[model samples]
Target chain A: MSLQDILTTGTAPKRVAAGMGFWKSLFSALDTPVAAPSSVPADDPLAGYGPQAVEITPAIAANQRLILSTRRDIDLQELEALCDAVGWSRRPVRKVRRALDNSFLVVSLWEQLAQQRRLIGFARATSDHAFNATIWDVVINPSFQGQGLGRVLMEYVIAQLQQAEIPNITLFADPHVVDFYRRLGFVLDPEGIKGMFWYPS
Target chain B: MSLQDILTTGTAPKRVAAGMGFWKSLFSALDTPVAAPSSVPADDPLAGYGPQAVEITPAIAANQRLILSTRRDIDLQELEALCDAVGWSRRPVRKVRRALDNSFLVVSLWEQLAQQRRLIGFARATSDHAFNATIWDVVINPSFQGQGLGRVLMEYVIAQLQQAEIPNITLFADPHVVDFYRRLGFVLDPEGIKGMFWYPS
Candidate 1:
């Protein structure tokens, strides 16, 4: 298939999966109303689940082992490896470092799926930190595919921002993922935000 | 004249004046062949030599002021003020704030022109902070008109950046100010950087 077909047509399966996952989670919650836990254990590996889960700090040191084991922030030593992962043109390490440092927030979600602490999924946000937030870099590592980790990560991040009382959050979903976000309470902003990108040649 | 006519005909000289002040300050060093100063005291009172100085920070306590000032940070309040000053409509402050915090290095320049610290000018840059910096938001106050302070400020900032040994510093200038930047060693970018603005009511 052509690139346009891949972007527009082949995305249906992912959308169906995301939609079914949203409904299943919603109905499952209604079916079993669990009591809200007062607090989560600091070291509880499963503390990220259910209501009343403890806060996840953004500090790398707080979760350094998880970060390192998941290989989330790998050094971009090779151009081909970097491009294969991010579809970005290869540039100097200095440039890549600068871009990574400038990212507003980079969130990595780890899950022990099939007996491995895998980088199930991740997302990056670009924002001014007070009022506006843009979600980007939503990806699921291929090894950890077919689980509901993407949705879990999304919901977790959304809850984090909501708890912080942030009012306006925005993101540009790949057209295929638009329906996924919509189902998760994001509306199709008719007058959506525009962004400009310049690549080093 | 209508507002559109005024803007198109360039009759609102005050707006132009503020813009010119910023442009002048940023490029002052290039006007003369003399080697520029190595650095200026961040609290240099002479920095506010132009017309529209706004003292966002106190001059006496330079170090403390830098700590307290959100000028370098993505400030929602100041972003609102900027939109108002430029006649743009309001937007979700969070998004703008994020963009500022993540992608831009904002520098707040102030001056004490009349025994009051006023924010006479400001500049934001998209840079690796090592190479390939693009400068934006060089503005000066209109009330503090006719002083050569604007040029001085520009020259000072550029010299500091140049001293860092980064090559390929760039900026986008309005048509009228193209020659101004040109004289300061910035050539016209034939493949201009993409720029867009959104105004929400």
Candidate 2:
């Protein structure tokens, strides 16, 4: 049988009456994989490309300028000039020093702005590396907001988590950001799953 | 106003509308500081709890007997005898050793079992402290199960976590045991919240 015939033969209905094979063969001829024309263009926004596209790396001191330029890390005095540019209050250098000691902070700096290497976005997670992980403080610089940087940063963080093979990860999001996370594969805890947060004033 | 009216005055429609307010008033009327409930009653079926209630301590060797008796950590010779009793094959000790070191292994027994006299059920977490905590291999031996020991252990762990102040905690449960955790205030991740597990051969 021709390749098309072979492929179509598999699609034929099983248990046909003895005299119906002829009709089945005719119907099967229409079952070719190529029958439907492709509607998506190479650049179609929704096309299934390979894996998600993004570059992510650990944040380093060298990227400080680009990061500070964005003023997202206003709590860090080193970024005070940038924060001033954006009308943010100057933060104490001691406060910045203390916050930097948390090991779980992973800042992603975009290379294109290397000279200005400000922390355009960052994520922080807490883990014991076996069963649980909690993600917090995920944010993208407002200037970088619409460029999909947040999603890219999140995907990168998730990939890192998958590599670590954590069994469960959880996060809380501002109610307004719920839809953004929902699209990124998060679900709301059910009605009864109350979260109690004790913030240090 | 009646106690019920006082309790119901300023509340959500559901809280006020539900008959729960009546029950709340009844409980409030009878509420008073009371003596602690007796530890698991002797006639309780779960009274089989004995050496199993051995508290976990920084030193674990002293409680070896209790540790070894648990289903998750059955004593090998005893297991062999039980296997012989049930006419099953005797497995190599290496099988148990391997199981103890598996990625799914979360609990870590310490140098001795009685030094501090506090039983611990701990799991390594997957991600960082800000987002989630996944509990794995959690158990308080049969003697400890029904006496709120598990809750105590969890509360201890939770308190430690609160110091870091992570926002969310998550865990997976066998389909049948989900409700037990639900009562402790865990809710299922919405549909499609997949939790993956890998077991070494």
Candidate 3:
């Protein structure tokens, strides 16, 4: 019987074989944790050359510039490497590429030294294009951490969303860096809005 | 000077007119709460006919069916009425329509009574179509509350996402209904995933 028939007639449907346990397994598949550690050590060559450093030798500072771009044509392998540098487990490159392509906007920060540019920070957001947007997978190259680049990247991303008139901004914060977001004016459980999730049995 | 020039040359950019306060105001716009009260009273015609009632009379149940659909072309006015029935503040119909149109999938549940159908529940999800999806604006016409249709609707939505291979599912929940979601195997702060919001300064 159709589900409608079963509902109206109170009759058991033929596909009753897929019971509650089946639904549980479906949710369980969602439980895989995709998280970056709260503390990541600098792991790249430019560790000492972060632009926000208090003191930099004139030669090193003159040629190095940090620039943000909305370019969606991100190099996937490089993104994977950046994620790895910040202690994220390997995510399938194909899935990561699809996520980037489908996102409403992608922002990348580049470190340019002389003629070479390296992808040092990245974040992307998905939005309804009018009402709300949530950022995902925000990461900065470990070599660029603690240099105020995360704040700059976040400021640029929020500015872009506001420019589009998407008024609501949200993100899933790892416990270790909740304060980092709080410093940027992010509130936890604001007006009783709490995040919920479902996982497989 | 361009932002790149400011960064590399240590020169203040001209538009320094809009400072941190401007950014704060942009985030503040997002602080408008779009929440449904955890306790909503029955306010519609089908208050007595929820299909899952153990004592539902045969006469009452014979002609009524609860059906779920993935129709994206939702009637925005009807949706507004249902949201009103559940005590949500009025959302501008134009923005609501845009939100629905931009969603990856929209699910609606209807109460079919022989010759007539009424919209009774609605929810929509946005997804990267591979790794993650977040459900939004879930509402059950208050008249149909406590009869298990909400659970039924959630199961259908989860099944649809699982079939599509979107493995991560999330939603923002009100404090009052945390247990309701937990009963369905949803965990709070799972693996230290906390929801954070950036609001106006």
Candidate 4:
């Protein structure tokens, strides 16, 4: 087909926010904690997608009750403040905006007040949706840290990746907190695949 | 705010196909090769958003002239056939559909005929649009390989990621192809930060 004919014919690849008809329902399902159907005889919401899914704990159940979303239409200044609150390295506001907007998955946590919700935790990941993914910039507001909100946020990220069947998840952790991620299933690099990277000279 | 209140008050994070607005123009621009803006002060098409971008390369110039897109409304059967052609690991049609639907970026190539566009090359990446992204499933119909089509396709992916200001891009390459990616400016990972991963047994 000629360029003109090809462009005019067949469905042009529309960017699916994946909110299209069926995927829309699935995306909505990700928004809420759904009960397993009695007819199915299984209570695990993620059973069909993959074998590995987190067993919901009391802490998770309570934390899940809080507002969690993959929403990108968030306040940047509010995000900037949340970054500051968590003692994160400084990132320019614009850089952070592009990052969040383009993130493959962003798990957002909020504290719902009488009339407004304040940002409380955030974790974002870059993934291929099939095989490999790397997570970065995980944070939970200091006041909310020990309350299992971080676990809820990370578990949500893990479940999302797991559901997509992406098995290779890699992250670089500081020496002090290696055990935190170890408990969540991350391990040291297997001997053969040395992690090599280059930065601006 | 209550869950109901937050859901109702703040935007429920409508899936920004992101292709709907400015990105649509860029997506369309990617479909058609644009002359570098010389007389115009802003030579960079992606300038307002980020600092780095690729000069639409010669290979890209040729490929763009062919017809390129991120359209997700694709035929799964056709994809299955393409996967068969490339000898990729078998993925069920449903899984292929879901993966394509969720990829952060997808670049498709077509050979324009009088009436139809035949899929000739394909590349995709999963990115957070900021810090990290991984490219995957880079395959070209064997008949279309070795024409620098792969380079053209990858350069497009790199440019898109660079524009998002995502600094860290990693991909697992076979030893033989390491130089190919290195020529395109990827380097060995830095020693201290090893790449580590885990999978469910």
Which candidate should be chosen as best, given lDDT against the real structure?
3
Query: What are the per-residue Cα lDDT tens digits for candidate 1 across B1-201?
Result: 332243234333221112332332212221233223345456543332332222222232334221111245434675566446655568776556555664445555554334554454555555444444556556555543344444544544454455444454555455655565555555442343222221121
lDDT of 3: 0.64
Please, what are the lDDT tens digits per residue for candidate 4 over residues B60-175? 22333244555666677776677789888787676677677767777665554334446777777777666667776777788766666566556556646654556777665545
Off by over 4 Å in 3: A1-60, B1-60
What DockQ does model 2 achieve? 0.06
State model 2's lDDT.
0.39
Candidate 3 interface RMSD after superposing interface residues: 8.1
* Weakest lDDT window of 10 consecutive positions for candidate 2 chain B: B12-21
Deviation from native of the Cα of residue A193 in model 1, angstroms: 4.9
Q: Taking the tens digit of each residue's C-alpha lDDT, what string does model 4 give over A38-133? A: 444463333332222222222223333245566666788888789899777787787788877766677777664334457888888776556667
Off by over 4 Å in 2: A1-75, A78-105, A111-114, A189-201, B1-138, B159-201
- List candidate 4 segments past 4 Å from native: A1-78, A85-87, A92-104, A108-120, A126-134, A140-153, A163-183, A187-201, B1-75, B109-120, B129-132, B141-149, B163-168, B174-176
Question: lDDT by residue for model 3 over A18-40, one digit each (tens)?
Answer: 22211100011111231243332
Q: Which runs in model 1 stand beyond 4 Å of their true positions?
A: A1-104, A111-115, A142-148, A174-176, A187-193, A197-201, B1-104, B108-117, B120-201
Q: DockQ of every model listed? A: 0.10, 0.06, 0.28, 0.21
Give all candidates' CA lDDT scores: 0.43, 0.39, 0.64, 0.55
lDDT by residue for model 3 (B64-94), tens: 7555667776778889899999889998888
